[model samples]
Target chain A: MTYVTDVPEMAVAPAGGPPGHGAVPAADTPTQWAAAYFDGYSTVGLLAVVGVLFLTVAFVGGRLLRPVVPTPEKLLTYECGVDPVGEGWAHTQVRYYVYAFLYVIFAVDSIFLFPWATVFAEPGFGGTTLVEMFVFLGFLTVGLLYAWKKGVLEWT
Target chain B: MNDTLEVALRLLAVFVIFLVLPLVIGQTEHKVMAHMQGRLGPMYAGGFHGWAQLVADGVKFAQKEDVVPANADRRVFQLAPAVALLPYLLVLVAIPIGPDNAVGEAIDAGIFFVLAVMGVGVLGSLMAGWASANKFSLLGGLRTAAQLLAYELPMLLTAASVAMAAGTVSLPGMLDAFEWWWVPWQIVGGVVFFVAGLAELQRPPFDAPVADSEIIFGAYTEYTGLRFALFLLAEYAGIVVLSGLTAVLFLGGWHGPFADELGWLWTLLKTLALAFVVIWLRATYPRLREDQLQKLAWTVLIPLALAQIALTGVVKVAIS
Candidate 1:
């Protein structure tokens, strides 16, 4: 029954809005705001727990009803009927690690963009935020272009 | 006490939705793919067009032997499916079905929360691949990680465009702030998000990670019985989440005629329609080669997503 309000919208009161109509009141303590914020996440965590319980139930049910006979062949790692060669932990291509490094850089950039996106078009903060973001993105674009020129983005 | 009861009931409802929607999508895929390929898919399973086909499959899988490969890292192999399956369930909790208090839990930063949680799902396949102790599974896992790295940028960028246009990161807030024009405005972001989402889920065309022809089902090569079925369920659940998100972020979430009363129906309709498109894509296109897959994400989708963000910024400033 409790509505979870958008924190950013409430925290940054619009330029000319009167207090107590829809804008958050000063009387609301930060702790109350923090609790309300985490209440939503706690629900997410609870749902995740429920999901795990559901899968656990299904697996338990399967364990009760299904056979568990394990012959030597049955338990063998499958490699088209032949025994698995060498180790399962083979040395993979280094290209994947490069992609991962790129992902980390851009992923951080993307995270910064989320809050910027939320606040970018606000009443007092429109043009300035837009120019700032484009500058940030300009730097990122250079990095991406560098990767492309170096053939690091190429999968092969 | 009252709040506890309310939370309990909401969790229960979301749990029911989490269990039901994926099976429905799975059955729809079977029938749709069957008809598209000119074959009657599972006509007799539930006595009418295989209505209960997935249910029957569930029972059959439960009855089969639960095989854990001798070489597998037993705990990680067992836990991977749960890791894959739960993130979708968590994302579903934040998705609003209708206007005004209709979501399971309305997070403040709903867009960021969903994107972050969804990214964790990919690690499940990676874990499965590493733990399976099969060469193919390892390859599949590595490929999944690489594909995720390539595609996640576009997905994040596209979703960011919608958040910027709406001027909020919350899903319900985005819907509340929705205008009819955003459909055209965010169309490119919508397409990129959906395609990247499909690729993230390892659906066909971007399913080089799991292309059975080459890698023998990839990270799932060593799984059987209910364990294997859990992975399949994760895939379908991913489809439902992706479709639901695309509907909310792009087409408009639960906005239509008589939306006050019929909002949830509109949301459901849009989600299912997108799910059909997902199946249609699988039936239509051949899987891309691994290089092509990475190229599509980095070269095409990422650039397009960035442009869409710039366009969103321009539009936002112009209209204001």
Candidate 2:
């Protein structure tokens, strides 16, 4: 799963253990890479499946062991013992969504930084990528600054 | 057949850790929080310092009725616990405890995968909030969405800084690349990462989303019995993952005396030590106001994380 070697060969090799002692050698060809990619992800998928199974088993075991007695009062939405008031879906502050929108844009943009970071220090790529990233980040900063100036970042 | 057996054993090991570590953290919190507050917490439940308090709690939760609110969206409300609990388990699979691929599954883009999966975890609370059909639940849900969004950037940015510094995205690769000097070099990013990760998990100080005084457990207000317990367990599991990550990314995980033979011990000790700090913070600080929480994330953590990234780049270039 190591991508250290996957990056174009650097003059100073990236900080990976010698082959067989460190990271599993990344596949060379595209086909092998994809296979290796999914091979790893399949375990993640399996874990997710196992997680769901574990929870389901716990819940079922609870159901089998627990008592079931549902009173209307017991099932009511708890509001610190107050009887239900207006609808549960109350209108929340619109300000939250504004920040959420800002986050979405910035988050999507930052995703590019991950891969860039992996390759940023490779000898030949160092200067070029560093300048390129700051340039990219400069644009992101402008957007953040614009939002800041617009008072959109204000939480009130 | 041998390979399958090895995989099975590894999966089993991960499963055991996923189940057990949270309980360990949970019990530790019970006592640590008690001692910090000058009380002896849970001294009776399991005999020796209430060691089995969490086990007792699990039994108590199981025997209790699984209550779903009458006004709730039944299926989503019921499903929310699983959604919240599973991502941490998925993450536990990828965190390397020692060198030589000591991980449940080593994804190529390990850091990216971890951050992405953890980001998905917030949806569990959002879903719980929405489906519970309670006003407080909705508010809590909305707060979670906003806080998670606010902090996610710093978390990602800081992680990217580490990945950049290490020159790889794999967790083991990061550990393999870890130099003791990184403890000093990446300290700022490490703090920001841990703080932001805490905010992401909605742990105290950042736990406005579930403030019991204001929202009555927020997204979990309507949950009862085993369902509520699952949410609590998810939180402890989150603490373990976050601490483990902080250990690997900054603390030079498994890089102590006699590291080769005793690497896993070092990693575990570091993680537990950080987890203790987490509990200490909860005992020491009151919850922050919602606005204050957002302001800190947007104004402070994000900028610090960005600067850390730039610093890492400059330093890497200088030495290279």
Candidate 3:
């Protein structure tokens, strides 16, 4: 999957290891050309090879190691250690999840407002920044206050 | 050399990323979620704690039994899971993950556009449920639609406040200023947006569509093999996309403690940390009531989002 060497004349290094080229640096080196995990060839065309290397490594590693053992028991629907009885896919408490889901929707909206106000001092950007952020936060707040008064945030 | 070639090459790089990065992050999400819940997720997979879980999962899915219900609509059933997944995968194309101006904007309305398009994921879930030829699954899909439609509005509103404040929709430029992040004035708004994203991602406490206890895996009940894999991909991909958006819009995009050389790594680390939070929420919280979920969205989240927007406006007007 390492496409870098797969381009044209470039030879690819094996997965998890870089190309066969030594770790030699060019003349005007900036200290060192560090190879943290793996290093690839220095050719321009092989740059995207990192992606190929990445795919190959991930796929191979996953296939060779992850066990595929599935007994009749292992295939049962998760029952928290209870002996499996009916089909695992039976309908149960979806509405409860829906409630939590709705809450999550509202809660996520609240995470954005603070940072919007923090960047207000970039030269002539303060006033413009404030107006835009507020307009944005406006819709968010309305949604929240509505939910709150409606007693949605209150846990039973 | 030529613009088209460069762009094409870049797009190719992006395609490779579509494969490699998601595989890495998606597996990490599973590992993190597993650990947070006091379980070892992939401990036996790839020598080191199931590092190969996702890859194995992908392969297994590709080869495992591909079952479609005899009564199901084959074309739509197949397409639904893809629908759930494709938009999230496609949206990653325009995302500048490295922080700063490393990647220029492909579309000017980056935040707005992504937020709007992201909503399409619900449709896939909806279609999956409907096409499954199962009552439980269809209901589950509708639940997702209801949950999302309600929440997307506030999510947009919260993002709207930031886009409004930035004065431009270019995410990288907003981070280039790199002064104040979006976490302060609208802490409330940030919280809401994050919660909405959690719901959208179908994480715990809000995992209605696939609620095993209720709908027997709900909309995905009829799916097996590759289609189920696509749904899983969409789930993890959605998490990554939301994490990236959170980092960009609220946490200062690419602005880390060192916004110079380590900017790109810092942005990824931050987004990675946020993804951990999503996993954390799954570990810590219990599911809520259905009525409460909707009430929270329409009554609580939307109003708060609107108020934050209004207050932001008033404060700006007064100061200026």
Query: Candidate 1 vs candidate 2: which has greater DockQ?
Result: 1
Chain A TM-score relative to the true structure, per candidate: 0.77, 0.75, 0.39
Fnat of each prediction, in sequence: 0.79, 0.75, 0.07
lDDT of each: 0.88, 0.86, 0.63
Query: Model 2: per-residue lDDT, tens digit, A1-156?
Result: 254322223211333324454544444555555564566776677777888788879988998999999999998988779898987987765756778788899888888888787777886887888898788778878888888898876866
Stretches of candidate 3 above 4 Å error? A1-156, B318-320
Scored against the true structure, residue B180 in model 1 reaches a CA lDDT of 94
Q: Residue B255 of model 2: what lDDT?
A: 90
Per-residue lDDT of B239 in model 2: 97
| Residue range B161-254, candidate 1, lDDT tens digits | 9989988888988999999999999999999999999999999988999999999999999989898998999999999999999999999989
The estimated TM-scores of all candidates read 0.94, 0.93, 0.69
Cα displacement (Å) at residue A43, model 1: 1.8
How much is B56 displaced in model 1, in angstroms? 0.7
Model 3, B1-320: lDDT tens digits are 56446555755655665666667777776777776777777777778877888778777876665565655677898778767766775566556756433542244445655775688877888888777766667668777876776677678777766654554555654555435735687677778888888887777878876788877887887777766877887787788888888877777766766667777787688778888888777778887656667767766776777777776565555554
Superposition error at A27 for model 3 (Å): 44
